[model samples]
Target: MSHPIYLTKSDLKTARSCTTKLYYKKLGYPTVDRVDGYTRILADGNFIVSKIAHLLYPDGIYISANLKTEESLINAAQETIAYLQQDNVILFEPVLYHNHKLARADILVKQGDRTEIIEIRAKGFDSKAHEDLIRYRKLSYFRNKRTGKVGGEWRYIIEDVAYQVGILQEMLAQHLPDLQIEIAPYLLVPDRAKTTSIDNLASYFQIQRLSTHRNSFSKFNGIAVNFTGDVQEIEKDQFLTKVSIETEVAELIEPTLTSAQKYLDYLIEQSSEIFAPISKGCKSCEYRASDRDDRDGFRQCWGDLADVEPHVLDLYQMGRIGGHETPLVNEMILQGKASMFDVPLEVLDDDTYSYRQLIQIEYTQKNKEWVSEQLPTILKQIEYPIHFIDFETSRMVIPYRAGMQTYEQVAFQWSCHTIAEPEAPAIQTEWLDLENTFPNFQFAESLMEVLGDRGTILTWATHENSVLRDIYYQMQVYGYHNPQLQTWLANTAKLGTKGKSNLVDMNALTLKHYFHPLMKGRTSLKCVLPAIWKTNPYLHEIPDFQQYYREVDGEILSPYDVLPQLQIGDRIQVVNEGAGAMLAYQDLMFGENRNLGIDNQAMRSQWEELLYQYCRLDTMAMVIIWKHWQKLCAEVL
Candidate 1:
C-alpha cells in the first residue's frame, strides 16, 4: 500500500523550523537526526512522565494508536469521536483530525460546556526563575520581553501546542458544528522552582520494556510504567505542575494553522522542491551528507558549493572575524565565495578578529603545523604528580531523590589518571555509585581524597570547573561541614570567582598555541585526539596504547571508537559518551530489567565495568595529548 501524505503535528513543527526539512522528512530522505544516546534517555524520561500524567485522572480512557500508520490515525480519530460523545469525560492521547492534518493531545478533558487540552513535556521550567521572561497571561515564554519578538529557547514547545489547538479547533468546527465549547490550553511540565515533598518519588516508577532488545529505552511504544506507590500521594505532592497557556496559543494558532495549510498544499501540488534560502544555519542542518545509501539533501541544495575542500565554513571563528551584521560565511555566500582561500588575509587585521583565527587561516593555507615558541616555558612550569580527571553526570528531568527540584545535576562517577613524576606510569583511580541514593556529596568527597593538594589539575574544557562549582554550592546547601573539601573547591574551582584557580584548561592552551591542518578548526577532545593519532604513527607503537590501535578496512580508528561493547540478549550496548553513561545509570538504578528474576548482580557488575573503562579512556585521552605536546616541546628546546 502507498503511504498517505498527512501533515502531522510533528510535520508542522518541522515546517516551522525549515520548510525544506519538512520535504526531506516526508520523502524519507536519510538525515542525521536519528535517535541517539542522549535523545533515548530523554524519550525514556518523557514516557515515564506521560504515565504519571495519567495517574491524576483514574477515570480517563486511553486511546492507543500506531501514530506511524495512516490507518491507525483514522481508527483512533473514530475512537476519540466516540469518547467525545459523552457529556463529561477525560481522555489521554485523543486523536484530532481536520483538513488532512492530525494531532494527538496529551490530555483532553470535557465537562459540560468546558473543554481543555494539556500537553505534557519532559522539559523543565522554573516559574520563579523565569517569571521575568514570561508575559502575564499572554504567554509563558514564547516571546522576548524587551523585543516583543518570538525568540525564547522553548518557543518550539509553545508553537507545538499552538498547532494542536488550531487543528483541534478545526476538527470541532467540522464534526461538532453546533456544540459551543470553551477551549483552554495548558502545559504540564516539571517545575524546577518547586520541590517535591515525597522522598524517592522518581525511583518509585520503573520503566519496563515489552521489546526483547535490551537498550530499548527509546522505544516508547513498548514501555509500561511499573509504579510502586500510591497514585493519590503523587497528586497531593504535585510532582509536575499544569500551566495554562491559553493566551499563548491564541496568539499563535491562526498564523501557524494557515502556514501549515499552505505547506500541505505545496506538498500536494509542487513538482520541484521548495528550497529554503541558504544561510549560516544550514551549517548545522541534519540533512547533510552521511555514510548512508541515500541522496544527500544538502548536496542537492548547495550543488558544487557543498563539495568545496577547506570550505569557508571550516574557518575558525568565521562569523566573529568579519564584524558583519550577518555571519561571514552568509555574507560570503551572497558574494559567491565558498573556499577558505576566498577569505582575504586583510580581514584578519580587524580588532574584532583574534590572532588565533589569523594563525588558523595562515597555517591552514600553508598546509603546515604551527607550535608556539612559549610551549617550552609552559611545559617547564608544570609541577610533579600531574592529575588528569574526567567526570560523568546527569541532569535528569525527574529528581532521583527527595527534597530536590526537577532537572538537578547529579554527579555519579569520576575517573582520574595520576602521574607522580615525569616518565612515571599513569595510575588509574575511579569511583561509581549505582544504588538508588544521592551521589553528589559522596562523589565530591571521593574525588577530593584521590586528588591531593600537590598536583596540576588538568581538564579539557570549562565543564569540570562548572560542575565542581555547582557541587560546592550543593555541599553548602546540604550542610556538609568538611572544611578541607570547601578549601579544595575554592582553590581549584574558582572559575568565575576572584579567588586563584589551580585548574588548567588544556583546551585553552590548544586554542592559543596549537594548529594542525588535520584539526580543521575544531578543538573538541574527540576531534583533536583522532587528528593527532592519525598523524603521529609512533603513538600506535607504544605498548600501553597498542590495544586501541586497530585497522579496519585499511583505516585506523580513534581510541573512543574502540571502547568495549556488552551484549544483553540480542542487543549490544556501549558506554563511550556522556549520554550512554546517563542511560546506563538510569537502567542500573530504576530499570525493570534490573529487578527481574535474573542475575541482577552480574548485570550491575557489567555496567560498572563498562563505565570504568570508558571513564578511564577519557583520562587516558588527556594523558596521550599531554605526552605528544611534551615531546614536541622537548624537540624544540
Candidate 2:
C-alpha cells in the first residue's frame, strides 16, 4: 500500500527555481544545501522576529507539528481543520491539505466569511521606496517599477503566498462546500521605517538546536525557542508591519497552482522528462556535487560539457560580457560553447572584453601569472609601520537596544598586523567584545588606539572603510561623545570631499593590476591567497608564517584549509568565514538557552578564542599577500 505523496510549499518553490531539481530532490540526491531551515532562522535572527510576531498576535490556537513524520503532519492538518469550524478564531501554523497538496500559513484568522492568510518572512521591506510593490490593481506586486521585470526575491515571496492560498481554496471547497470564504493574503516582514522603543528586545528570544542522528530527516530534530526576559516589555514596541498582497496573490494563484500541479505529476510518476536548460545559473546549483560523486545532477544534465576545465563560466564576470539583461553565457550555451578554450577569439578581440578578462583569458591559456608593469610602482607608495587590518561585523535583523534602527551594523571584532619597517616582524594586536553591552563605540575606540595617527591602513575591500563610516554616522545618531574616535573615523572612514580617507582597498588593487591563473575570475582574498601561497615557495621558510603550513598525506594544504578547530563538547567546529563569525557572535550573546554543559562564562571564553584565531588569520593572510607582492616587485627591480 502506497501512502499519498503530499506536495509542500518548499517543494513548489524548488520546482519553480529549477524543474530538474525536483527530480534530484525527490530521489534523495546529494546536495551542498545541507543547512536546515532551523539553522538559517537562528543565523538570520528571524527566530526573534517570529517570537515577536507570536507576541503581537497574543490569542491563537496553535497547531503543533515537528514535521518529522507524516503522522504528525496529518494530525496537525486535522487539528487546523477542526479549529477552522469555529465562528471567530485565530490559528498559528494552520495546515490546509487537499489532493495531496498542502501548506501551513504562519498565522490564519477566521471571522464569519473572511479568512486572513499571513506569511512571515525575514526579508526587509521599505514602505517609502516600495510603496508601489503592493499596489491593489497590479498584475504582480513583484514587478520592479523601473525594469518592468519581476524582481527575483519579490517574485519568490509572492509565489509562496499564492501556492498556500491555492491549497487553502482547494481545501475549503472540499471540506466545507457550503461555507463561503473571502481569502486575503498578507506578508508580515520587518519594516525598516519603524523603530523599536524597547532596549535589548533581541536579547529576549533565544535559540536552541536539539541533537539528532546524521541520517535524520533534518540536521537537528528541531529548534526550540526560549524567552530570557519579560514579554510585556516587547509588547510596548511595534517593529513589524503587515502589508496586504491580496490582489497580487489573486493574479498568481491560478498560475502557481498550474505549475505546482505539473511538479506534483512529475513527483507522482517519478518522471525525468522535465527539461531545465543549462545556463549561467547552473554554476550556482546546490545539487551539483562538490567532489567526485554520482548524484551530481548538474553533471547529469551537462555531461561532457560539465567536465571542461577552465570552463566558459570561469571567465571573469562572464555575465557582464553581453550586459546583465541578456548574458553572453546563455548565448554560448545555446551555441554549444562550454569549454573556456572553445571561446571564439573574435569575442575576445571585441572591445567589450575588459582588460581584466583579457588577462584572465591570456594567462589562463598560457598557464602562467601576469604582473602588471604598474604594480611595482603602486607597491612603492606605502610608508613604514604598514597596518594590515580586518574587521568582523554583523547586521542583525533586529537591533539589540532602543534608539537603534532594524538591521543596524554591529562591529564586534577587529585584528591588526603592523610592520614598523621593511623586513621587520609583523606585530599582532586584536580586540573582541563578548560582554552584554553595545560594542560599536568601544570597538572603534580600541581600533583607533592600535592604528593611531600614522602609517597607511590597508583592508581587503571597501568593507573596513564602510564599517568605520557606518560607525561615524552611528556616533552622531547615538550621541556618542568621543572626540579622538570621531576625528580618526572622519580621516580614515569617510569618503569623497567631506573627509581625507587614507584606507586603501587591496581588492581594488588586485582588480586593476593583479591576475593569477590559479585565481580564475575571482579577486577575493581567499582566492588570491592560495594562488600566491602555492606558487611562491619563499613564504614557506618564514618562521612566523610556518604555523599556517602543514603536510597531511604528503600533500601541503592552504592556510585556510588548516584553520584551528574549537571543540564544544561533542562537536568540533571551525570559524573561518564571515558568516561563521556572525553565528559565533550570536552564540556568545544568546547561547544561555543552549545546554552545552559548560557554564556561560566558559562558553563565552571558548567562543572568543575561536573567533580570535579566525580573525587573526584574516589579517595574517593580508600580510602574506603584501609580502608576496613586495618580493615580486623587488625581483622586477
Candidate 3:
C-alpha cells in the first residue's frame, strides 16, 4: 500500500506524537474544525507580512504554488531548477526536496554562483526560529548534497539576521560536524526607506542615508537587484519570502519514507514509552480519553516517571476518585510533590475521620484567607434589573454556511433567571429546551419579552452575546425577520461595544480579582465553587446533562430511562457524601485543597446554600465584578 504524503511541519509533529492521530489525519478527519478568530487574524497577518518580505527581492521567480499533492511538489521543484538556469530569479514559495522529504521556502535568491536563502517569519526573531533555521539548514545541507565538499558556502538573509545568528550558531555547532559556513545578515528596509543596506554606517547617523539607499541593492556575484517594490503587489500577490536553505548533499538522496510517514512510525514505536502516566506530556495528548482508568497501561507507558510529580495526570485521576477529597488530591497534585498512591494512610491518625477527611482539613487550613478576603468584595457590587444567563451550545467543525469560517456554535438551550429589582423575586426564563427538538421561535420571542429595552443582562462570558449575534445573523440570512430580535441586537452592539454585551467572564474575573484557599491555586468555577461556597453542583450530579446528551445521541440509552434512574434526591445524596470524599482524595493525590476550611456545620449549611445560590449568583457575580472593574478603571483614570 502507498503511504500517505503529509508534508507540513504540523503534520510531522502530529505523526511523531500519535499514530492514531496521523491515521485520522490521513483519513481526512479534522483535528480542528475551525481555527479561533485570534488565530485566523494572526495567520492572515503573517501571510501579509510574508508577502511584503518577499518584495525585498522583487525579481524573484515563484517556483511553486501551495500544493497539497506530492506530484505537484515535484513539478514545482523542477520548475524552480529550470527558472534558476535562466536569470537571477528571486524564487518565491519554492518547494525543494531532500531525501524524498519536501520543504517550501518563502524566498530563494539565486544570485550568480551563490544561492542565498532568505526565510521570513511573521513573529519577531526568537530562539525558536533560530532552532527551526538550524534544522532547515541541516535538512538543506543534507538534501543539497554539499556534505563531502569542504569549501561550500550558504548565506541566510532574514528579517532580524543579527539576533537569529546566535541561535543559528548554537544549532550549527550541535548539528553540523565541522562544516565552514558564512552567514550574512540583512535587515529589511523600513516602510519609509527608499534604499536598503545600512551596513557599516553609524546606527544613529545613518538613518537618512539608509532611508535614501533602501530601494537600491548592492552587487552580489556581479548581479544587481532592487529591494524597493512590494513583493505582494508583484504578480497579483502570489508569493511569500520565507526561504529554507540547505546544501546540495542533502538534496540528491532519497529516503524510503516521507517525513510524515517516518514520524508516524516513530510514534508507533515509542507509543508505550510516551504514553506514561506522568503529566509531563499528558496535557495535550490525544490518548488521554483511553488512559482514564488504565493504571497498568499508565505504568507500562509512564511508570518509570511516576516518581516525578504529575500535574494534569493527578487532576485527571482526582476527578475519578470523587468528593471533598477530590480538591485535596487536586491541591496535592498541583503542589508537585506526591501522587495519590504515595500518600501514607497512617498519617491520618483521626480514626473517626477517613483519610479523605484529614486531607480536606489540611487543604482548608492552607487557602481560606484568600477566598474570605476576595469573596465579599466580589459579591457586593451587584444591582437590580439583572439577568442570569447560561448557554448550552455545541461547536461543529467545518463552516456550515457561506461566509462562516470553520466551526460555528449552535445554541441549543439557555437557562436564565431575571430579577427586576434587588428586593423583588426573580423569574426563571429559558429558551430552546432540550425536551423539544423543534424550532422554538416562541421561546426566543418570550426571552426577548423579558429582555425588553435592556438593563444589565449578565452572562458568565461573552459567549452569550456571540450566540445571540449568530442567531440574529442566521435569522437574517434565512429571511426570518423578527423586528424585536433585530432591535435587541442593534442595542446590544451599541451598548456592549462590538458584540461584547456588557458580558463578563467569571473565570477571567476570578483570576483577576480573587483567590481561594480551597481552590488549591486553581481558578476554575468547579474548583472555586466548593472552596468559597463549600458546595459543588457537579458533585453527584448523576448523568450530567452534557454526558446524557452524548449517550442519547449515540443511541446507547433512552432519555426517559436515564433521568428516572438518577432520582434528584439520590443525586443530592451523592453530592453530599461524595463532596468530602473527593476533596480528601484530592489532598492525597495533589497536596492540599488550599481553599478548604474547618468543618463548621453551621457555616457548612450556610455555604451549601451559598454554593447553590452562588451558581444562581454567577450572573450577578459577573455584573458585580464588571461594575467593580469599571469603577477601578475610572478611579485610575
Assess every candidate by TM-score.
0.93, 0.91, 0.37
Among all windows of 10 consecutive residues in model 2, the one with the lowest summed lDDT is: 212-221
Badly placed stretches (over 4 Å) of model 1 are: 67-72, 130-142, 210-219, 271-273, 288-292, 321-325, 334-336, 349-354, 495-497, 596-600
Candidate number of the best TM-score = 1
Worst 10 residues of 1 by lDDT: 212-221
lDDT digits (tens) for residues 1-637 of candidate 3? 1242433434444554554454444444433323433443334334434545654565766552535456665565566556655435676655554333445555556555445545554333223443453576643321224543312222212212322333233333544436344533332211211112222111111001111221011111122222333333343422222233233212211221343345545444444432223333433434322323332322333444444532324332233333454434444445554443444345444443343333433444453322224444544564567776765453322122323322334454455677677545456655442221223344456667777765666665466667776766667755777887777765663333444455445665565455444554355544554343333223223221222222335443322123222122112311222122222222211112212356533333333332233233333333333334444444434
Against the true structure, candidate 2 has what lDDT? Answer: 0.78
Global Cα RMSD, each model: 2.9, 3.3, 20.6
Alpha carbon deviation, residue 334, candidate 2 (Å): 4.9
Q: Output the TM-score of candidate 2.
A: 0.91
lDDT values for all models: 0.79, 0.78, 0.41
Report the lDDT of model 1 for residue 84.
72
Maximum-lDDT candidate: 1
Candidate 1 lDDT over 1-637, as tens digits, reads 1266678777887787778888888777788857778998898788878878888878888776665566766777778777777899999878887667877788999998888898888888777645655545443465666766555766677777888888777877877788888889988888888887778777788887777333111224667778888887888875687887777778888888888888888787763545587766677778855676467877877778888988877777776656657557777888877888887777777554457778877888798767899977887798978999998888877776667888788888989999899999888899997767878878988999999789799998987887889888888877878888888887789746577568888898898778788787788888888887877899888776777887799888998999989876557878888788888888777775455455556666777888888888989899889888988888888
lDDT of 2 by residue, 166-214 (tens): 9888877877888888999998877787777878766666677667432
Q: Candidate 2, which segments miss by more than 4 Å at Cα?
A: 1-4, 36-44, 66-75, 128-143, 147-152, 213-221, 290-294, 323-328, 331-337, 349-353, 496-500, 592-600
